[model samples]
Target chain A: MTRDSSSTLPAPPALFDTAVVAGVGLIGGSVALGLRQRLLARRVIGLDASPEVLREALALGVVDEIQTAPGEWLRAADLVVLAAPMRALAPLARDLAPFLNPHALVTDVGSVKGGIAAEMERLGVRSFVAGHPMAGSERGGVTHARAALLENAVWVLTPTDHTPLTALSRARTLVESLGGAPVVMPPDAHDALVATISHLPYLASLAMTHMVARDERLSLLAAGGFRDLTRVASGDPRMSRDMVVENKGALREALARFRRQLERLEADLDEPDELLAAALEGKRTRDSLPIVKRSLLPQRHDLVVAVPDRPNQLGAVTQTLGAHGVNIKDIEVLAIREDGGAVRLGLESPEDVQRAAGILAAEGFEVRGRS
Target chain B: MTRDSSSTLPAPPALFDTAVVAGVGLIGGSVALGLRQRLLARRVIGLDASPEVLREALALGVVDEIQTAPGEWLRAADLVVLAAPMRALAPLARDLAPFLNPHALVTDVGSVKGGIAAEMERLGVRSFVAGHPMAGSERGGVTHARAALLENAVWVLTPTDHTPLTALSRARTLVESLGGAPVVMPPDAHDALVATISHLPYLASLAMTHMVARDERLSLLAAGGFRDLTRVASGDPRMSRDMVVENKGALREALARFRRQLERLEADLDEPDELLAAALEGKRTRDSLPIVKRSLLPQRHDLVVAVPDRPNQLGAVTQTLGAHGVNIKDIEVLAIREDGGAVRLGLESPEDVQRAAGILAAEGFEVRGRS
Candidate 1:
């Protein structure tokens, strides 16, 4: 919980020392704002292709200065962050290579690492370290930037065998300064892992969204369930398109594996009696997941008690616990009516159960243990 | 906004009036609760396999009485609702065939309808209507029941040509009483639509969750994007298994289309130029959706004006807007530093933009158009 400030790392030259943020939109603008808030930089400079966006960024104060030329800006910046589209990594690296400061540590905020690393190699930006701040919202652009967006989020750094230890340490320190947890890994491993977790999911959401879109009636009938499932598909298409295309091999592998799961479930559906036993087994297996994996913690604890079957009985029980300074961590009304019912109460500690039971019994209610 | 009291129908005779709820769990329990709360039922009787569940249901006042014996319950009730597992629909119908009240209308809350409809026909329940209330949370079980869970949700009803007009009208009334909007369609069409909109999304979520589960380290690194995308995968395993199994055909088609999309994107990824162009196109398409779809209104009409980079700029802008009695819907600092920055002001209407801009200009702050 405590900040590590003993690294003896030199303070950023100025509170806002000419931060050159390439592709100044959501992530970049937020980084610029965060640096200013923490006094990490004295001035935030921005680079972008769209003049409208540049004007928007400048008007929004996302950057103190806007540079039309990347090379010129890179030469002047102490720290350069590439926050552009994933596919532009190669050209962007090439543009920065010739003008990069000798002491400057260039990094990126791209989702995929292997591709960025390959691009950097092609661009001859040997000093660059690949970094991705695992933070974002569905909404994009500088207008959506928030200073504390990166706080407590994991910032992953993927470095090659040839990457310098000093540069790696610098990147880690920068991530930590922003209140982010830094995780280090190799480029290929990062790409493969992200393919499974990030890239494939985006494609899956898109596929599902597109499927619904095909049936106009179904699309209109879509409720929160549909909305929640397809929310990711509504993200920046360019980002999604790049992610799916860049990590195709890994994504294809993941999709194939996923299809197998569906096929297995489909087989069970065709024969219910035979599958019924297996289905029950599957249910038990699902139920025993926490037991099988000792590392996993139960979402809530278990407790048993009795309450009236009257309206708002669950509410009343919770209210009573709240009043007595006893928190009913989680409650499961086993049964209810105007007469009586059993309810399971999840508590933070076993000791609280005794007090809670007593409190309810005093209110003319019956109480019992779960078993 | 007002309830139409004149349209309220009188209750049927007690002997001929009974609410039948199959598989009395969360959704079923909530339906029973709603029936009682709105006085839509003369008597509420529940059918469940587990005696403990039946006891709990009665004790909680979720039902007027419990019928542990399925045959007896199905025969006595005037309205029968199927809320059991999707896999159980066929067998349950078969079991209730000989006992069903001659004039009783059967309906269900199964996520998929085509599979259930086939089972219903086999069981000789020609009057059955399949339905899905597109409202539910990650949580399940009777304990989580809420009377208002169906409010404002879309309740879809699928009926065949043989469906009686009286039965359909009755079902509509029940759905409307629960504060739900009813959408009717054919069984096959319902299944196909849900495959795209509902079942497909769940499978997508499950696949995403599974993908993350494969990589322990990457799973730990998952942030909001990963969490949001996979939220539906955390639903009850039994229910999910049944849904996937029952809706296999349509889900398979959905998965196939999704795979094709991934393949195309993968091909494009090999060519960086094409990939970048695609990404840009996606970005443009997503960005323009709010404008293109005039019906999908933006959350805020208030403009966010980027203030020039300067200290106290936000304070000065807020004070000026406050003086004009133009309440600030929301305020965001797009970027800030020692030199200057922009502040976005959310107004109540587009008309308020002019007044706010004039006020900020007079206060010596550079104001811009709404984002």
Candidate 2:
């Protein structure tokens, strides 16, 4: 019934007098915008090797102040986000080390955490919390950055053994202030987990794409499933290469595990039960994963309704839900037919899903989905 | 400026007096609807073992007549489309052979083709044209059936050496009339291609999902890329199992090819250039895949515009396109930022893309994308 684009997360108490976001690319620019929009810091500064990027950030109001490079200006900051490319993170942190105030809690938005945390420690940035916001776009750079990119994103904060409690708390507080879910874990654990969930998946997609490339005609036959399976392969090659290389140990282990699974599947081709079990297991696990909505806030519960493919069917379904006082967080036309169609409605809560399903079913709509 | 959802392809002349579609499931129902809507046949007779399905098809107006099973009614059909389960195709063809008119051209909509083609050959259905329509939905059954499902779809027709030229020509004509792009290939070739592009990718997704399911926390950390990579894993297990099992030989070869690619990636992890080269290759191939639009009609050309994240930015872009006499075929909000956002506009032709890009750039908008 309502389309609220505004933030619903509670305003946070101002945590910093100043925050410096280095690099001013997608991640850094987004961090600056989030700090400014959420009022997490009084003054936000942008630092980048490129003056043009800094000027763009300043003109866009992503940062209140701009710096061509890290300098004494960092002393005024309570927070510093190192969001340069993977290769540049250590050097940027090392350059800012002497200028940073003792109380300043530094963090980063790197895909790999253990290497960066160790690098930061070597650079004497003691107040460092390695962070990875599990959010991105195929498009990169500040021009494609937005404060909303962090909204309800699972921001993993990997704290090393030597990391100060105050630094970790401050980093978590900043992540929370930006409307990101702060998930705290050890650096090695974060790297290992991401290797399975993120890095290995990217490699698999790339490998699959490569396999398809062997036969020029294979791409012509690839349907929507193949496109979706290999979507991540189109991401920046240098960046993907850096992540995979940095986490190669964990990635190799994950690849071996995946290979074993394929072997099992290939061996059990004759026995439909094993294949069916694996598919069912996959479906169950994938269904259980939280559906990331536009805002990525309070999870949305979805239900599919089989409606007659006539005029105003969608209007009627929405109206029926509206009458029941159920707000549809998201809706999509999954398939269209002249005689019948399937529409998926995303509700805010499980209770709302139950209520809407019961009401719709009574109204002669066949509804089914994971609530 | 114009939004025409109507078929642009030439209207098909009535090629069949009566077309019989066996098993009114999603594929069968869609085929029947396509035949009727496209005026490819004067009448469509639906046949299924279940009277309930037959009744539903008749009630839905997807067929002119309904039959519980193949019998004397099949003698009137000039075209027969076996759109049943993969396992049921051969037996259904065998059962229908006794009643089918000698002039009737037979075809199927199975994912795998070689085995089915050979089985049809053994059944004395020498007129069979094995087909695999690369169009499907995660949702199945007649409820989600649509005539548009075949529109612009790559419908592969694998005609065996013994297949009659009349049958092959009729099959291709029917496919074209349904707004499908018919691709003719050998049965073994079709199976091999789909195994690499469809079946193997499905297994890879399934394997990745299984690997991720090993860690309960991994899913929590998964972002959009992971979800998309594993999306096909949630498809119908029974159907997916049948597909993989039926095409086991080609699938096993595809699996081995994929493993070799992954092994190469693992070996080259330490070599950034090699890894980067693979990623670049994958990116190039993935990017080259055609964008599938809602209508799935004539191919649409795309361009990305970096618009300022201000109110009415999208409205202004559309208005600009409209003023320039360019119609947007498909539009998507790729990313949003307070200062900038990436909007991808799909135009009807490459010329339209060039003109629109130049016009937008002249109007102070930054546009970049594949043409």
Model 2, B1-371: lDDT tens digits are: 23222413222235677999998999999999987864557799999998888888888888999888778878888899999898787788788889988888888899999888988778787888999888888789888899878777889999988999988987886776565778999999999998988898888888878877888878776647788788888888888888899999999988888889989999999888989999999999988876662233465366767666556768878998899899998886654544556666878877888999888777766676451
lDDT per residue for candidate 2 within A1-371, as digits (tens), equals 33222423222224577889988999889999988865557789898889999889988989999888777777888888999999887778789898988888899999999888998788788999999998888789999889878877888899988999988877876786576778899988988898888888888888888877888887777757788888888888899888889888888888888889889988889888887888899889887776662334565466767666556768888998898899998786544544556666878887888999998776766676451
lDDT of 2 at A26: 92
Superposed Cα RMSD, model 2: 18.4
Clashing pairs in 2: none
- Candidate 1 lDDT, tens digit per residue, B155-199? 889887877787887787667656566889998777777776666
Alpha carbon lDDT at A10, candidate 2? 23
Off by over 4 Å in 2: A1-13, A293-371, B1-14, B293-371
lDDT of 1: 0.67
Model 2 scores a TM of 0.76
Distance from true position, residue B238, model 1, in Å? 1.4
When summed lDDT is taken over every stretch of 10 residues in candidate 2 chain A, the lowest stretch is A3-12
Question: Which lDDT values do the candidates have, in the order given?
Answer: 0.67, 0.81
What DockQ results do all the predictions give, each relative to the true complex?
0.14, 0.44
